[model samples]
Target: MALMTKLKHVDLLADGSLRYRRRIPLVAQEAVGKKVFQQRLQSKEGADLIKEYAEIESLYEQMVAQRLVRARKEALWGNTPRETFKAAKVSSESVWEGVRGLDRDDPEDRHLVAASLKDEGVKKLILNPNKTEPKPTLKDALKLYRKERVKDDAAMETRITRVWSEVEEAIGDLPLDELKRENARKVRDHMISVEKYGGGNRSAATVKRMLNVVKAVVSFGLVEFDLGDKTNPFIGLKVDDQGDREDTKRLPLPDDLTERLRASLRGDLAHIMTILDETGARVGEIVGLEGADLFLDHETPYIHIRPNTTRRLKTDSSNRMVPLTDAAQKSFKAALKEAETGGPIWPQYSRPRGSDSASAALMKNLRKLTKDRKFTIHSLRHRFKDRCRDVGMPKNIQDQLLGHSSVDVGERVYGSPEAKLRLAAQWIEKLT
Candidate 1:
């Protein structure tokens, strides 16, 4: 009981170790999820006890600071006073937890404890549980934005997350209101000139997309956090043209390269590439294919492209039945046989937010096949379009086969799926 006699909130167990125990504040009960916070001091000696207590108390203070930041963010997002109080209470408990036990004999320890309390108070004031004027940091903005968007648009979420990661790397967590035009320019320059995005200077298309993602997130944060009146630094920001790299346009794979890819790729990757080459279906579409989506036995053997729980088509025009060529039919049969075990055609790649993962794996395999980075798995679709055009397929028919919105008003508004399918099947037969 020597430790207990010296320190308040410190209990001496039968084995002689000291323990600190305190009840969690009533307001923070929900957030902290505990009636009491307890930590064993793991020391019997007075000096060791004091040192360990200070360390633990410092950690507890840090925890409270974090909770307070969370509470303040909730308030900014329009959480009620009662809800914010829970977080405030947790923070208050953290400060008290740090200063609860005092060694009156040790003046240095007491001074250290007082200084820590002052530091915590300063942090709490800065966080300001009640006020919501100054917007949250770009870091917090990104965090909240991702939470809201990930459910609806995982691809966009991924892109935003990636862009923000680069931004964060270039400049540490900056306040949203403090994100000046200069900061925006720095980020753009960093991405295009300094950062090796995709192993080289970011192409013009990549720079534009990254800037767009940053701008969209900033815009979203302004609206979501009710800071719309604040100037958006990302708006009207320009990235110097890094020349016309044609980054987004996947080049058509030549016949020689196509043959090599077919021979080289194996397993699900091979099947995915084959489907892409023959059907011109997107990698996401093919990877997300289901047994039910395949209509092989029907009059027109085709793969139905539709949004499912796991994957979403890029646009409304993306939803259609692509008539299978003889080669595509063979690939689908092999994929179907594998899918007999149940779930999607490529179950391993069939994740709700997994298009990037699928693309990355395919790219790694592709690097082995060819040195040209432009000739990706997506190039199969471009190659398909080239082949369709070379064989004298009409523009409307080509658009239907590739799931592109037809430019012609009549074809776009009046074209039926069945009619398009017949035209597509005929053109596809020519290629086969």
Candidate 2:
């Protein structure tokens, strides 16, 4: 605001020329990286010099604003100027200012300018015009999602990775924002072209799971990048589940089959099946047990189902103690001899995809043992529930024993592991 003559911050030089000068705001001095802006004016003529002075002053105003915006962004998001633009975190005004200085003849600059002009939000994404990296693609989205969602379930990891890889291949790894509804449809159609999971052409259920993988990644990326929810191209996507008509529902193992399999199984599978049937624990939970997880010497013999290096529990509630049945105790004692003291009880099936490998092997045998497809290894878990419910066990206690979240949160989550184990032992002992 220093005015020597008629114009503000315009200094009349000793050599009879006009100079444009101004001190930067105190708060913004560090961000601007200078105490003041001083420029020797090129125009010495009457009205031209005044116009030149005005233009120089306006440019400095913009420079200060741009620098302050960058400082705020760095403070808030910890991103530098170039990273802010790349991440779509820069303001439109800042982007426009940065792009304004670029030479349009340069191919790189021309592309950025063209892209900004073409976009509805003008200059919004033109942060660093000199450095335009590839757009974030679907595969990138999946990689980021997997990194955040840590899971030791090797089977699911393998399955989901393949599902996303198939989508990426079908869609040529399209950028997340560039992914269209048609691209999702194409992926859905491509997945349904096979009959792998079930007999007779591909199932509608199969296509839905495939599409869900795409939806999950896209949704996760949109949120992670602070893109609006509606921007997720895969939202509201639908896949028809009207094909194949096959009964995929699992049925509880009949009492006769349960007894026969229990008696028939020997070695590790016998012990595993015993634990699965006796305590409604999932197969992954059973196979993940290290010798340390078993508390046989305690007053209430039990096994702790928890997250370990080899496997992650399905949910936080999955970490609990389940009292062992007499059959389960005997089986654990036998299985313990297979490992090195407190090491993994089932070493062969205790690593990534180990539980999956075990499941596939057990399922092959299970398929041979039963005529019905519904009576798979998982049916043993159902039989355990049926047995628990049949013996008049409280639904809350049943949910605790099964590692399932319950409607009665107090009953399911409000006890010491010992107290819970004692209660579980009392009810589970009632089971045959």
TM-score of each prediction: 0.67, 0.61
Q: Which stretches of candidate 2 lie over 4 Å from their true place?
A: 1-134, 144-160, 189-213, 220-230, 239-246
CA lDDT of each candidate?
0.69, 0.69
Model 1 alpha-carbon drift over 4 Å, by segment? 1-86, 89-135, 143-156, 193-202, 223-229, 240-242, 245-249, 340-342
Per-residue lDDT, model 2, residue 45, is: 61
* Total residue pair clashes for candidate 2: 0
Cα RMSD to the true fold for all candidates: 18.0, 27.8
The Cα error of candidate 2 at residue 27, in Å, is: 63
**lDDT score, candidate 1, position 46:** 55
Q: Give the range of the ten consecutive residues with the poorest summed lDDT in model 1.
A: 194-203
Cand. 2 Cα-lDDT: 0.69
Q: What does candidate 1 score on TM? A: 0.67
Q: For residues 373-392, could you state the per-residue lDDT of candidate 1 as single tens digits?
A: 57776788899999998899
